[model samples]
Target chain A: MTLNASRQRLLGPDSLKPLNEGFEVIGAFNPGAVRVDKETVLLVRVAEKPLAVRSGFVGLPRVVSGGSVSVDWTPEVELDLRDKRVVRRKADGIARLTSLSHLRVFRRREGGSGWTPGPALLPETSAEEYGIEDPRITTIDGLHWITYVAVSRHGAATALASTTDFVAFERHGVIFPPENKDVVLFPRMIEGMHVALHRPTTRTDFCRPEIWLARSPDLLHWGQHQPILCGLNPWESERVGAGPPPIQVDEGWLVIYHGCGPSQGSEEVGAYCAGAALLDLNDPTRIVSRSVQPTMRPAVEFERNGFVPNVVFPTGLIDHGARLSVYYGAADTAVGLADLSRDELLSSLN
Target chain B: MTLNASRQRLLGPDSLKPLNEGFEVIGAFNPGAVRVDKETVLLVRVAEKPLAVRSGFVGLPRVVSGGSVSVDWTPEVELDLRDKRVVRRKADGIARLTSLSHLRVFRRREGGSGWTPGPALLPETSAEEYGIEDPRITTIDGLHWITYVAVSRHGAATALASTTDFVAFERHGVIFPPENKDVVLFPRMIEGMHVALHRPTTRTDFCRPEIWLARSPDLLHWGQHQPILCGLNPWESERVGAGPPPIQVDEGWLVIYHGCGPSQGSEEVGAYCAGAALLDLNDPTRIVSRSVQPTMRPAVEFERNGFVPNVVFPTGLIDHGARLSVYYGAADTAVGLADLSRDELLSSLN
Candidate 1:
């Protein structure tokens, strides 16, 4: 079957308004998308920084104890600012993000082209003092469960929150603890258990960044973890993580994931590309097939250069019967979209 | 109150047998102790390494998939081996331990001075692939719950297991995820909840190593985390963690904890010392009083030099009416005991 491929930029940093007069939007990307009635809602991660950064200082923004955003300025000489996203202290080797992120809602009519931005979901708890980032949403029994990365002094942990409607949300503390991210829950329970895919980073050299499966009786308490997949091909040799909630197909579960490999021009940075995998229908933990090459790469100008270069981080996937729409973060700065025929995407995985 | 202080080495690396013919015990320390019937049971952490290392290579030991230990050899030139405990790769910057650790049982009769070594607790699950270390035991309702640091590619996570008798253990999986350790469970439930003190390390500069409180209805699922205590004084400024299960006293909960500060002679290494703190009786999260000065430091010969220098890491504490016993790992090479008057120790915290 022939495939019709369409790609475009959905939202850029310049398109969205800042949180306040003192802050500027640095990134508007990595949206978690789901269809609500007649409109498609996008929970976009908006990274913001203080508008006035001193000439000789680096301002680190965080949510303080009273739920107010605060910026702490450190002298430029004390920081190693080689990376655009992070600032590392020279003395203690401690690192902090250059900007803070919060989830903002965006919506578009079923057949409309233009999108309208709505209210933001800001950091509320101590666990999200730094930010809440890269949300992945899954609707289970009518409730849209949003899994996002909660950044705090403890580390980057996966936290869960749910909403019957996008306007009202209930926070459900942390599910997976620190040094973990990229958690995506399946749309429904598999064999009477809630299944999720997560990427837990390793401190030791024995393991690399790979996707693991966990089953929970309740979504809050996760256990029975098993390593399902790891980086195998050259394009995904460094790391791999689940992009969106897996979609059930006739053969099995279709999974879209992002893989980080060595960049073509830069040695220090990684080029993130999108790939596909299929898990067994009965047992989601067992892998059925995986793409030998990346399905999508940093081919466009928006994906090539920005706050972070050469990145196409897919975080949301929407299945529309015969077609699928993929929402991704472009170079950590703006949101981009890619649409492909469902049959063609499945055949490419094989 | 008149105080009587006595310190002595109970077990050293030379005294314990190695795990296998090819492996040699490098360190035997950091024990979790509890009273069982007429005897004191100690679960000592035993660190072991391969007997032979190539002249220009460093050996890293870890538990492989089939419950067997294996060693990987890497060129010494590619590793930064400045630290005796860790070897970091120069290219990728990933770090690994030089030795693998397992828990071994040591039994001593009441009022006895000798410790008889027994069966070892080896790494059985994938989570404990790098080995287990620093176990803390607290008995509640006739069952002894053991909280230990399970090291693997995933990082140093806290895992729980329980036993009615010390011989057989039922693994309860990981209660707290990676980059966390130093977990000590309270002997009994407070306000109908099981309380635990843990140290979850941070990847960012926002937080330092501090003791935090978490409550759970069941031991498997833990939540409601609150930061309790952090290092304040110079002698305990670098980091702090709970030593053992807190002893319930008339005034409050008396906690023994370890504090890491700058070493007297070495600028690169930290000196681990023991201190005391009192938490509010009703709310264990509130700090009542803490010691401004350490109750015990690395003053003895065994504590001053060995696998890791200038360290006296207290892992277990026992109360004997008017007297108290502090069991600690000395320089990560030997186990030492310190005796202090119960009344004097309580007064010292003020």
Candidate 2:
């Protein structure tokens, strides 16, 4: 427990711009990258296009079931991926799904037709069959939130929309739904409310999926779920995420995560580096000092070298006062950089 | 959650008699059965009398220096026993020198030669090196409690010793010391304080080995803890225990435990049923309902026959308004009987 170092990059992913509005941009992979005002935003992973091709797959978005609902896809259904239990069964098998139907999100905007994809906010909830994916962002008193993950047919949750400018979005349906995801949220209002960082998982066998901590006051319900870190051991025995939007430092609030190795479900190989903990800025679920190791990993070669390899995730972090940067995302196709200082990643957490 | 049957049998295994007065009484063999009033206790699993004889093998307990605390009792230590981290580092390296040696506790009082085995609660400190063994007893309001599992060299804790009558015991020293054991206590006092049922064994690997829950504003300083009961599926995927001494009725707090299947460690087998859950007598960590099976199993033949076959092990229970008797102990050797009707075990937990 002693993290302080900082520095990694891809922040303005590449000269900014992009949101030319043609719709369909990309790379919000596990984004959530926040920094706001001084710039370093990005919730961008967008994926929208479809004016002709109907059979080869069009745009997908029609869902309208009754109870366990989740059927959105205009491509006229051809997707099945062998139904792992038709969205965890119950009340009939209800097909018409899609799961990895091509994720979304996009936002570099400055006035152009190069990015613009956004909205689809909780679109047909149930996991979109598999479309929503990573977002992050932060802000508080002036609005702007994000959080993302969504998936569908009926599983994977996270979500939480909001927006005061990026064009318009209000959603909020799932604040921390289902088996949970990497959620971040903790930019401000520590004692006045809103604090996040969740994980959830456990089907039992004495637990394994760790990292919890809720509280909300009004960012849409949420109350003290608690728990906070317990995942098996040795640098997070298999799962551990949430890497950007947390910072604040002087002595508390840190965060910076990503600790894999041993996962077989969401495809986790390892190393995206960085680790930290220090919470308690008025009970951010206490903690106060963590980081058994990892202050910035993936060395370089665009963070190690396509759709998935060594990896370098990040998402966003800017710092300023002592220069910290960190905006990753490399093996999922482009965007990478790095830097240091900020007490060398909180002195490698002890 | 309905439980209310009654009859009576608070302790057997011959209900405390041994006072042989010298120290060699035998019998103690896994008496984790619980209960506390009119008396029906027996945490008996005794196996004392062995200190040193390595080569010619007399009492087994070698591993002196650098060999790390000792206790190999070699047969190649049961042929490697599936390397559970070297069987938990050889059970914490022979419990740091047999938790300090020399001990005694053998009751069976009536007159004198009829049974003699007391006088040795010795060890003013150093956790009796390796003394305390199977005790399980509970009483609540009027006092009379005991939890045993103590050892030494710093390992295997869960030791609370109390007594208003059985003769002497008042020690309270290691109340849940090392790595933990099957504690059990919840005979009364749910909202007023005192509620135990421990089982700590998390040698890492991200948590497994559970069954936690503390609460004791005074029973001697326990706090909230909470885990309740995990290690789910397949009649307990191996390891789970807390059977005897939790029965309340009027809907909730039944307990009856003992689960262990995939063995090699002490040659595992199964049997011995009776599951129940429904706490919150004022927030005993909530719960409210559980027990999808097992209300009394191991059918017949003194409960499936002896030294460790099937195994029954209840410890004690009484109720007696008309039904609910349950004294149990069968496989570790004698003392059985079974009755039903506390509404037929709360209608088999619905």
Candidate 3:
């Protein structure tokens, strides 16, 4: 615990009720940002769906002609049942793993949170036949733009949409296409173009996922793929992705990203946290400084237990000079807030 | 499934073994390097100790005060009961966990194939109160050095040792005083100094476990701390630690590390896997590439089960030109092999 900060339940369990009912309001892992009416807001990727059934797994249970159940052989997908190398899910389905069909958002209204729920953003494309997840919202000039993961059989692809207010969003179609997520745009104009951070997933032996800097004159079409950050280090030796929008720190542009490590057991997916890296304000890809550790984690029950556990996603950040407030989703269930000083975050990175 | 090129073994109850002698072998995570002969090897951190009686645990049972065998709330520590985490024989004082008694060689002699046994290194060390576990071996010039997690009641610390042969070893004083593991040395010397990767656990508002780079002229003394990688990704955002010895590629040096994501109910940890990163050969601290998905995971039964299951630790890597023969310990039990071509590993990092 190098970070000795007090924990506060800024948004406790069931704080954003009614609107958040029947669904989990979790941080989108990578939160997107957009500015409208002079106030900064977040496009939080909130996942909400029905619980799934797992009893019908291949080897866990043998179904007879009459629908009787008996143990025969173990299932291949049930990799967690036999070994401790992977995380195992409850076959009964009583235990909630994650589902696809749903996603929503949480906006900061009137400079404060816990306001009346705004408009709900749902998936509108076929690529997200399963559902859309992990939205990264960025605004250019007056137009609000969002890039999200559209999930279907083809896997997760990046899609784009725009909105002026929390309500009335105009679909901008799929911006980056499939196998991509974690898209964040730089505020203002860079060389008279929109610069965004995007990670495209490709199939390779090493599974290398890197953050690329892309520029777009219009919010829809992106060009000039420049490498911003690569996932090749001891801390994030495996996979690296982005989180939230890059905050304007004095030294440079501070962007929070996510890095991955290996798992310990069957079917168990590891956790995600917040890490910060400073990019050149003008270039937006050059590295200045980065946090060596995460800003937050899934330590509480709501964070450690749920459909998918050990997950603290930072979908948005609000910088208030000395204080920085971060709104994140926990355990794929509810939204939570964690605050720290700008000085504290910068000092801790060293 | 891309690694289906190697020999695959389930090695469950169906496979032959020293019956009832099954156990788990977790990665000390990132182990220290020890150069022996013309080869570089990793001193893997292994924790195989005899099981202790569970008398006070919440879910465990105990004997009653009466002579009869009744469920008791509180029992003696000396009494042996069902302990899931430890692998020991209560009847005899012998234990499998690191005792200053043994060290298994990653490179064994002939006839050392499937279900074969190899000789241990030095059976004893003056500094090892509980023996060495999870060793990270590195080679600088011709000298081979190993930094490992040495444990005693005083708490765990990183200890350095030098070895030229798989049989003999020379102990260097503790490189890191205490509360440290996941140490990897840069393959090449940087600025006439030895660069190493390490993580010192500290308590922060969020659990701050990060990978750091340190410089040392002498392998034992470390200075010039630089923050290289951060665990801010969604997959491994919880706590990121180092994994295997770094592999040198054309683009950069590749280091595989382990990360713990969000936890599940009743379980504080989740899945562990092998993730790769490319770093500057000269700087050693600058990251070049990273992976978004895991290269090797707990996909098989042996890789998924065991003492404290769900762990796949790759401590030894033998590069045979086109293929990388990765010898890994599955679920802390036995050794298994997987192969990935140099092309695949490099391409995945893109």
Candidate 4:
């Protein structure tokens, strides 16, 4: 098994106490983490929904202007409300959610084992009308930079935000166009150029949601995009995306990623699994080895039930010199941790 | 017995399933009601507590200001947090709460069997700094006049609000000062003056929280205060309070109220039971006859277990000619109902 049961910390939505007295932290997962000095600063994506009374129907609380809240509701029969973590609205043929998303940063100091919350980052621009989500952090030249998916009616686009203290942030506008997401910037410059791994969509392409490599002279402008990886194995026949920043090794660059199987059974609809691929040190375009099968798949109950069930999407990775800590969202309900030996993963890079 | 156990409807906070979606409606009891045309409109006091991840301690959500909330937590070692509904700071001292209460109105049309939720009424005014709870509705000539307890740090005071459509409300300022609660206005004015049944506090009085009567000409200015009844039997050795608006009957004004025993055991601390009494038609201050014992007590699991265990506080009643539907808060969790013959209760009154 690529991931083991030993030394795992599954931080569920319950892990986050009430944001304040009235607001609840429903989903505290899909976090972006970086080791900052004596702490692991986690840019946790926390989804907060308003509190309301429920009878035959439910009243959903929504934020109004001027710091006020208003409630809206739908009868149990009128709406097919199934999951507690999701707010779904049926359109055309697919179900969509009406609720917005925001991110809350948490700092877990080395000595203090628990996560302490910080101020919330909300969707401010029209590009982020649907709210920003699922950030991936890369610390370059001491400053921690976050690349997240900005969603709106236009589609999903990559946006950048940088912070040193995690309290204050500098916005760097949308880095990619619509119908694109799962973007991650390399921790350091490669061959004197900034490199980023992202998944781009092509309507007619058989292999959809494939990971690609792009080089940029500056962090903003990009060019020479090459399709680096596609869904190959049966476990990854549906979609594949880069997970965390590639870890540098003597052999090459160790890249961890997530993939899903073909949509067949209920468990396979969106079941996520983790895998690793090794890329050449000098030229990332050259692939050395790739895992033939998923290194890790959903196993525990926490990974089997959530807003989206049967999933384990790893996003945050920290090298503790001896062991590697993988921080991932368990079933899209909570932040989970799985530890692996650094030496073992390096030897089994394929 | 004054009450029968046939064909019951008990609603606790758990009955509110939507609130059960992402949050927990710890208590949905102590409701007030009035028959509006073919609909039975109920104003339910719902106490929602945010779900927090529990380890060594859990943070309790509390309302702050500007429609925002905050949390104050105590470690499990320092504070005794046994009850899922309540949070107590100390073991021996008066128990403190970590939740905020809000009121939700539900309209159950005569033809409709279940309660359909309406808009939620939030704590807006300064008088309702903490919350507005356990309302009693009196339909005078046309409009439904609601009198409820406004709780804050200052004290629990009596406040008034009138609604004609149940959609719009006209707030009438605080009618009674702090350290007072359980205010219910009479349906019809007697002696060309408005009469109200209330519960007043007297520190030196052995029978604390006794029912009292007051006369008002304008409904705002009250006078001629007189204690109507007090705790009598061992089942009600602690305190008693007026329930819903007294029903007008031929024998006299029939009143079904709640009482509690001495809070010596854990089960009895907040244990509430229902009782009945008859008062003079013209002079409500004079109790014609009162129940020698409790008419109804916590029996079902829903009534005996909740945020406050063993609590059955009756606050709403609907006359259906053949049978009286006594709607009550069960175990301080959900709404409950019990059917009893009108004639039986009148004859059983001692």
Q: Model 4, range A239-332, lDDT digits (tens) per residue?
A: 7888887878777888888998865564325689888888889888778988777777888877877767878888888878677788887777
Considering lDDT, which of the candidate structures 2 and 3 is the better prediction for this target?
A: 3
Tens digits of lDDT, candidate 3, A1-350 = 12444544444335443232234333333335444555555555544332223364422221224422223333446433432211234442111123333344445546564533456676545445445677766655666667677653333546777777767877665555334577777766777876678775532111245676766665555544545676544445555777776777777787777765444475345676667778887878688777666666567776777555676766666677887766666665555567767787777664
Error of 3 at A272 (Å): 1.6
- Order the candidates by TM-score, highest first — what do you get? 1, 4, 3, 2
Better of 1 and 3 by lDDT: 1
Segments in model 1 whose C-alpha atoms lie over 4 Å from true places: A1-5, A202-205, A263-268, A281-283, B1-4, B202-205, B262-268
Lowest lDDT block of 10, candidate 3 chain B: B13-22
All candidates: TM-score:
0.92, 0.27, 0.43, 0.47
Instruction: Give lDDT tens digits, candidate 2, residues B1-350.
Output: 32333322222334443332322323334443333343343435433333344663223232233322234355434332332111222322232221122223334423332334444443344444445555667777677687766554334455577776555778766544345567788877766666787765532212245566665645554534445675454454455667556767666676666555454356545444546556655665566666666565556664565545566566555566447656555665555546656666656653
What lDDT does each candidate get? 0.85, 0.52, 0.54, 0.71
Sort by DockQ, top down from the best: 1, 2, 3, 4
Interface RMSD of each: 3.2, 15.3, 20.7, 34.4
> What TM-score should be assigned to candidate 4?
0.47
- As for TM-score, the candidate ahead, 2 or 3, is 3
lDDT of 2 by residue, A1-350 (tens): 32333333333224232332222332334455454454345564433322234454534433344322232334323433232212211222233322232323445533343444454343454334345665677777778787766654334456777887665677665555334567778878676767777664432212345566665666654544445664334556656767666877778777776666453465445544556667766676667666776665555565565445556666556577576766656655455545656676666565
Q: Candidate 2: deviation at residue A290, Å?
A: 23
Q: Score the docking of each candidate (DockQ).
A: 0.33, 0.02, 0.01, 0.01
